[model samples]
Target: MNASLFCMAIFSVTLNAVAQIALRKTMLTLGALPSSLITAFSFLTNLIGNFWFLGGMLCYAVSIGAWMIVLSKAEVSAAYPLLSIGYLITAAIGYFFLGEHVNTTRLIGIGIICIGIVVISRSA
Candidate 1:
């Protein structure tokens, strides 16, 4: 991919990561749900009111638009690996924002994913 396309891909990946993290943050706000249908409905109703969740959905819409741009510029097979970059981005966000742990094993796995993305980008 050229500079603009690559930048778009990175932006798409970043937006996706933000969406995923936002959804996660939204979920954390809701504690364990009751098993009753009425309680579940109430919980769902409250979830709808969250601005962050709505923003996350908007992020998803923009991410799709960016993805479409990437697809128009390159083959899906070559561009798809860029999606996995979301995992890497979200891990860091989760660590800092959510206080989630990122131990050696997770770091190693993320490293492998990074290597794969690098190889795939080179192939395109």
Candidate 2:
């Protein structure tokens, strides 16, 4: 991939990762959703005021734009594997920021994902 296209992919993936982390934090604060729309709306309004929700929304907006650019330049099959980069980043953020576990098996899986991304990039 060209430099600009590669940067776009990275931005898309990073934003996606950050968004996942932010959303997870927001959900933890908000707890489970209520069945009633009114209750849900009220909770959402409160939730939106939280930093995590706003940060996630910002990241999501940026990711959408970057992803469109990436899709324009690369085939979906070639580009879709890039999403795993997001997963890896999100897993790290989840573990570090949210105090989630990162067992040996999961670490090994992440290592495999890194190898896959490297292989895919080389193929492109």
Candidate 3:
């Protein structure tokens, strides 16, 4: 891929990963959301009012636009696999920013994902 397209792909995936992390943090901040229909409605109302949650939604919209550009520049089959890069990004964010632990098995899984991405990129 050209540098511009590659950068956009990376940006798109980063936004995807970051949005998820932000949303998770937002939920954690909210704490102990209910599963019942009425309580869920109240939860949704509060969630929608939060700026961070809205920002996460906005990130998704922007990421989708970037992803479309990536699609235009590259094969969907190739571009889609690159989204796994988000898993790596999220895992790193969770580890460094959120104080989340990464076990050996998770590291190995991430390694396998990296290998698969390399294989897929070579195919393109």
Candidate 4:
């Protein structure tokens, strides 16, 4: 990937990571899902009103548009692995911004993923 393509890919990945985090945060606020049909409407209403949920969806929309541009210029084999960066990004945001825990094992796993992403990008 050239510089512009790489930038676009990273932008898409970042937006997607934000979306995932936002959606997860929204779910944390919303709690357990409603079981009954009657309660489902109320759940939907609450979800529709959630700022985090709306922001997440907006991120997803922009991410998809950016991803389509990336896909048009790059090979899927090269591009898809880039999405793994999302895991590291999400973990960092979760820990720093959301006060979520990041255990040693998860840190190790994230390190391994970073290494893999480097190797994969080099192969592209």
Q: What is the C-alpha RMSD of each candidate to the true structure, in Å?
A: 1.1, 1.8, 1.4, 0.9
lDDT digits (tens) for residues 1-124 of candidate 1:
7899988999999999999988887887876766899798888887898777888999999999999999999889988998898889999999998999999999999999999999988988
Residue 3 displacement in candidate 1 (angstroms): 0.9
TM-score, cand. 1: 0.94
Estimate the TM-score of every prediction: 0.94, 0.87, 0.92, 0.96
Report the lDDT tens digits of candidate 3 across residue range 36-57.
8979988888898987798889
Where model 4 places Cα greater than 4 Å from the true spot, the runs are none
Q: How many backbone clashes does candidate 4 have?
A: 0
The digit string of per-residue lDDT tens for model 2 on 1-124 reads 7888888998999998999899888989888887898798889788979898999999999999999999999988788888888878888888989999989999899999999999988887
Residues 1-124, candidate 4: write the lDDT tens digits.
9999999999999999999999998999999899999999999999999999999999999999999999999999999999999999999999999999999999999999999999999998
Comparing 1 and 2 on lDDT, the stronger one: 1
lDDT of each model, Cα atoms only?
0.90, 0.89, 0.91, 0.96
In model 2, state the lDDT of residue 45: 87
Order the candidate numbers by TM-score, best to worst: 4, 1, 3, 2
The candidate that achieves the highest TM-score relative to the unseen native structure: 4
Pairs in clash, predicted candidate 2: none
Native-referenced Cα lDDT, model 1 = 0.90
User: Pick by lDDT: which candidate is best?
Assistant: 4
